[model samples]
Target: MTPQRRVTLADIAAACGLSKATVSMVLRDNPQVHPNTRARVRAELDRQGYVYHRGAASLRRAGAVNAVALVVNDLANPFFAEFAAGVDAALAEAGHVLLLGSTGESVERQHAVLASLVEHDPAALILSPAEHSSAARLRRVLGARLPVLLFNRRLDGDGPGDWDYLALDNRAGARLATEHLLARGHRAIAFFGGHRDSSSCSERREGYRDALAAAGITPDPAWLIECAPTRQEAARQTPALFVRDPAPTAAVCYNDAVALGLMAGLAACGRRAGADFAVVGFDDIAESAFATPALTTIATEPRARGLQAARLVLARLRGELPASPHTTIAPVALQVRASTAAAPDSPLQSSVQARGPAA
Candidate 1:
């Protein structure tokens, strides 16, 4: 008996009852090949263990990995989860996939994630950086090396580089929340937040103060609380505000998580968010709408932001447009639910003192 020979292109073509030229075209990914024929050719290639040298290389060069890294400060955060879901939707629509990694709010961990992603050599990366990293360090290291699109958080001094960015106009959004509370006759408004060093947090705080200054209300140095980034921590520290001699009538939270936590803390002290004190949150996460008394919040357009960021990274990868170093969306409408209503009977008048805490 004749010994079996190694499978070749011709062998695949013969086995599939197709011509050598057709097989060759299929291997080359020539678009002229009919879909059925291409599929048949690929099937046969797999069966025969046939490898197309140039075709594989071309696929790699063209980003056939169809991957982009999504690095976030914390994956456990609901806001990030929503943002990641949006990113996944956009990527799926575009025939791509996302590689997710969480930094857990650590610069060293962020560095490690980026480094690990580099090993995969993804087409691009979307990042919400940890607070400790400097723009210069980011630029010096990851900026020049790959196309990075900043999402959610903006680093200080990163104007426009080869990278891209899409961020919320946090300052303007915070102002809207603050002014809304002020309009409801809540003069003593407090700002509760995460890290002060975070650009988004600082910008929100700035907006809060700007609104007060514009309204001729003196900024209270005691009104701002730099609390923890998590919901539990926000709950732990929020009671301090209630204990103050003149508790703020309304509080602007960093995000829905903090807002809900603050509400919990207030409840523990016999105060309710919508019934005893007004509360406004940012990010407008889905749960914010479901929270007891439903939260009033500044909508950040997370899905749109994620889609835009994906587009920016794809465009940069394709060399279609110059990297837009910075991009921001203005605050749109505020979602005023029971949490923000001054009273159940009136839409315009909020029940400041009756603000009920989240259940």
Candidate 2:
């Protein structure tokens, strides 16, 4: 038995007794085609089992497709999940689909994901780069064609390139968290979690240090604890903050995950979080609000940030923006909760007392 011949547009047009051009226009939903003619074309198409070759159509139309690529470091993290959800919501409203890729914080994995996504001819790319990612390396994989919007992490040699960037106000947010702790009379505060090499972590640490210096209190060298920005690692490393002579009374955590982990670790060590040790965290993930004693955090609003990132890409794609690269630093706000309090016998108590009840 031989395979049947595949039905073509010409076959459909012949059956409908209409010109191939007219049938093609109807198939594409072109406004030029009459409603009655479109109905007839559709009837003929259905009768002949005509399958629309979207890939072929996209190729013929110069690679125009309703899809965009979004690559992030860790999707399992609720922060990125919320961000991706926001991106998806915006894209869906704009009649576009999001092609997602998770790099798991590996530069090599990012290369592979981008290579695969490019084959699908995505209209644009939104990338949350892994730590130590370089501009030259990204350029090699992405080529010079597709528009890329960098999210959160910036490339090492980014310079003034023709790419858009959307990032949280990491330094300012961390400063807000640190300052909140200071306001509650915490002087010997530790900067907790996140690797020192990461750009976000580095900025957060700078903010922590800045807040301490502004209070005329130098942070102890041993108090700058470095760990993976993960709950498990933070929990394991929490004990180190209390190893030294002058133990820290508070901690400015890298993110909510670290803060929550530290809280759990404190429990294991027979120390209560809000009462015994004041804690403040950056990126108020959903779990932050429901944690034991609730978390005092800087809310970056990951989901809303994701929506803005998508809109930025859409604007660029529609040529609504200038040719020059754009950068947007989203603002953050502090959410004071039960997780912070004045230190026991704190030196700053005098300053708080002088300011009266408002302080």
Best-fitting candidate, measured by lDDT? 2
- Model 1 segments beyond 4 Å from truth? 1-24, 27-65, 140-143, 156-162, 323-326, 341-359
Candidate 1 has an lDDT of 0.78
Per-model TM-score, in order, reads 0.84, 0.91
Worst 10 residues of 2 by lDDT: 349-358
Clashes of 1: 17
Alpha carbon lDDT at 339, candidate 1: 72
In the range 13-91, model 2's lDDT, one tens digit per residue, is 8998988889889887899888998999999899999987667778889645879999998889999999999999999
lDDT of each: 0.78, 0.88
Model 1 earns a TM-score of 0.84
Q: Give the poorly placed runs of model 2, Cα more than 4 Å off.
A: 1-11, 44-51, 346-359
Each prediction's RMSD to truth? 5.2, 3.7
Candidate 1 local lDDT, 1-359, one digit each (tens)? 85877667779889889898899889768999999989988988998777655334536466455678899877678888888888888888888878889989888888888878766767788989898676887665464667787776777666554456677888888998888887666788889967888888998899988999999988677788988767899889987786677767788898888999988888888877787788899988888889887889988867777777777777777778754554645455577776764533345453443243222
